[model samples]
Structure formats: C-alpha cells, structure tokens
Target: MPFTLVLPDGIQYVGLAFVSTIWLQIGQAVLVMSARKTAGIAYPRLYAEKAEEEASFLARKFNCTQRAHQNTLEQLPAIYTATVLSALKYPVFAASALGLWVIGRILYTSGYMTGEPQKRNTRGGFIGSLCTFALTCTGTYSIISLALAAA
Candidate 1:
C-alpha cells in the first residue's frame, strides 16, 4: 500500500516486478538447498569439497541446481532493467513480459531439478530466455523513443 505513494506510476506492475525479483531470490535459495541436500554435503563439508570432481550422481544434481541459479544471476540485472523501463513506457506489455519470464523461470528450475540442463533448454529455459530478450528489446526501444521525443 505504501509503495504506491513512493511509486505512483504503474504501481501494480512495479509491485509485480518486485515480486519477480523475490521469486528469483527464492529460486536461488531453493537451489542452494537442493544442491546441499543432493550432494549429501552440508555446511563445512559442502564448502570444503572440491568443485572440479563432480562425477557422483548427487554431485551432478547439485551442480545443475547451482548452474541454474548462476544462470539466473547472470540475467537478473537485464530483467530488472527491462522490467523497470517497460513498466514506465508500456505497462501492459511490461507486465506480460515480466510474467512470462517469471513463469518460465519457474519451469526452468523445475526442469533443472531433473539433473539435466539439456532438458531445461527443451522445456522452459529457452522460452524464458526468449521472453527476457523480448523485454530487453522493448525496453531499449522505449528508452530510445522517449529520449528522441524529449529531444
């Protein structure tokens, strides 16, 4: 409720954008837990284990979980930027794109948990990537058009 006062424009969509970020963070936490549990190496043991040798079934699953999270981390900034820009310029499209990205990420995570990153590409990871790309392109166009109009 208070957030509306601070962010007057597209409050609902902005809130959804914030929720998307929270979702990503939750995904990261879930992945960390999955990795720890799958690897059968908790705390110090997990930290002390060598990263290079991940031949064990559990280790592989843990790696997949970690990689999925890492991939998300890599794309998070772009997601945030695109969401913000699109929200400001085109609220409806922003919401749709952000929603797709969020949903796709959930599907991607589910596929990743199967211990096959390749499977993720076929499932939702590719779709998520496409959605994120669309967001970025839209945001770029919005910024450029707005800047040109201002000039």
Candidate 2:
C-alpha cells in the first residue's frame, strides 16, 4: 500500500471539539423549538412581531431563545473555519479554545433565555469572543507561516 494518512497529534481533541459544537447547535435549536411551543407561536413566523406592550411574556421569551440560537448559527462558520485552520499547526490550543467557545455559547444562551436581552452579554459571551479572536489570529498566523515555509 502506497497511500497513508497521517493526522496531527492532538487531532482527536479537535474532532471532539467539533462534535461538541454540533451538539451545542442542536441543543440550542431544541430550546428554541420548545420555547416556540410554549409561546403558541405558529410555524413560519420567525418571531413574535407584536408591539412590546401587546406581546405576551411567553412570546417575548420565545423570541429571545430564537435570537440566541440564530446568533449561534451565524457564528458557526467563523468558528469552524478558524478551528480547522488553527488545528493544522496548533491543534491543542485550537481545540481548547473551541471547547471554551462551546461552553460560552451555552451560558450565553441560558442567559438570553431569561428574556432580558442585556443578560446575553454575560461572561460567557466575553469568553467566546476572546476565544474566537485567538483562534482567528492563530489560524491566520499558521497559514501564513505554512505558505512562507513552502516557498
């Protein structure tokens, strides 16, 4: 056999981190679905659009949950890209940061579920932002370094 695949050390942790993100996304979706049911929101309505005074508390709560999940979905592309690129040269750090980001998202979602939008700016959000920044920087550096070395 002439073909072989050699994965970087600590790739397992990176794989686990990716799996955790998948589960986190699913969990957030489930929460939003449950909240929609509680709020009596019908299908195809993205959110409760009534005036604040007219909207029921449950409806407001459901909107909050939905927004939290949507926000997570928006961030996933950046998270996945940074994770994969950074893992090529810094698998352990990349995986660690990604793991923290997942935890932070969970906390951010829980806080947002309280129906107080301000609560969404929790420590978890800060942590997640910091981790994303680190990952982006690391991934950029890794790619540039690899390219220069190949030249």
Candidate 3:
C-alpha cells in the first residue's frame, strides 16, 4: 500500500507567503551584518564592549539592528507552525495573515534600526502580534475540527 496525502487548495499561497517571510528574515540578517561591519563590531562579541554613553552612534545602531533580527528569529518557530497548521483548513486566510506578519516585521525592523528601543513597538509590531494571535486561534480551530470529524 502507498500513502498519499491530500493538500488543500490555496496552500500554494501559504507556501509562497512563508517563503517570503524567510526571505524577509534573511534580509534582516544581512542588514545586521552590514551594520556590524559599519560599526566596526567583530564576531564573537554580540554587542559593543563600550558603555552606552561611550559607544559611537554607529555602534548603538548596530546593536539595535542585531536585536531586531534576533527578535524575529525568536518568534519565527511559532509563526511558521501556526501558518502551516492553520492552512490545513483556511489556506487563504493563513497566507494573508502570514503576509501581514511579514509586512509588520519589516516595519518593526525599520523602527528598531533607528537606535531607539522604544520605537520598536510601532504599529508594525501590533500588526504582527495580531496576525500571530489570529493564526494561533485558526490553527487551534483547524485541529479541533479535524479531530471532531475523525471521531
């Protein structure tokens, strides 16, 4: 016997959106690397050794850029999982949410790169959080629906 898996329609959109998010993450990492070089920060040292007051503006900016990317990495696993799981039942909605999440992350990175930590909580951040919450709820609903249908 052979095992065959059936995928829902519109799943391609979800896949494309997911790939876009990955590309966005890579772009953020590249920006961090560029900032690190511009700030003269070297590898193995996560941040500047100098005090905040003593650090050059470029150094401070580098730290913020790095942190922005780090925050995205921290959230990626959950976002990816929810995106895929939710697509099982609502592929279009999942894709749209993922797209919004990517846009929000871009805005969040832009604000954070300004070297003002507080600026990181921009409308983009709120949009991203909302999308994540929506995806989580949809994913949970999808799972329950599947289970109930099987029973």
Better of 2 and 3 by lDDT: 2
* lDDT of each residue in 42-65, candidate 1, tens digit only: 665433245533557677677677
Per-residue lDDT tens digits for candidate 3, residues 1-151, read 9999999999999989989988998999899999999988889888876684165888888999999899999999999999988999999999999999999999999999888877888738898999999999999999899999999
TM-score of each: 0.81, 0.94, 0.94
Root mean square deviation (Cα) for candidate 3: 1.3
lDDT per residue, candidate 2, 37-95, as tens digits?
99888889889877741568888889999999999999999989998899989999999
Ranking by TM-score: 3, 2, 1
Best by lDDT: 2
TM-score of 2: 0.94
| Quality of model 1 by C-alpha lDDT | 0.74
Task: Give lDDT for model 3.
Answer: 0.90
| Angstrom error at residue 48, model 1 | 9.5
Worst 10 residues of 2 by lDDT: 48-57
Candidate 1: which pairs clash?
A: none
In model 2, what lDDT does residue 122 have?
A: 76
What's the CA RMSD for each of the models? Answer: 4.3, 1.8, 1.3
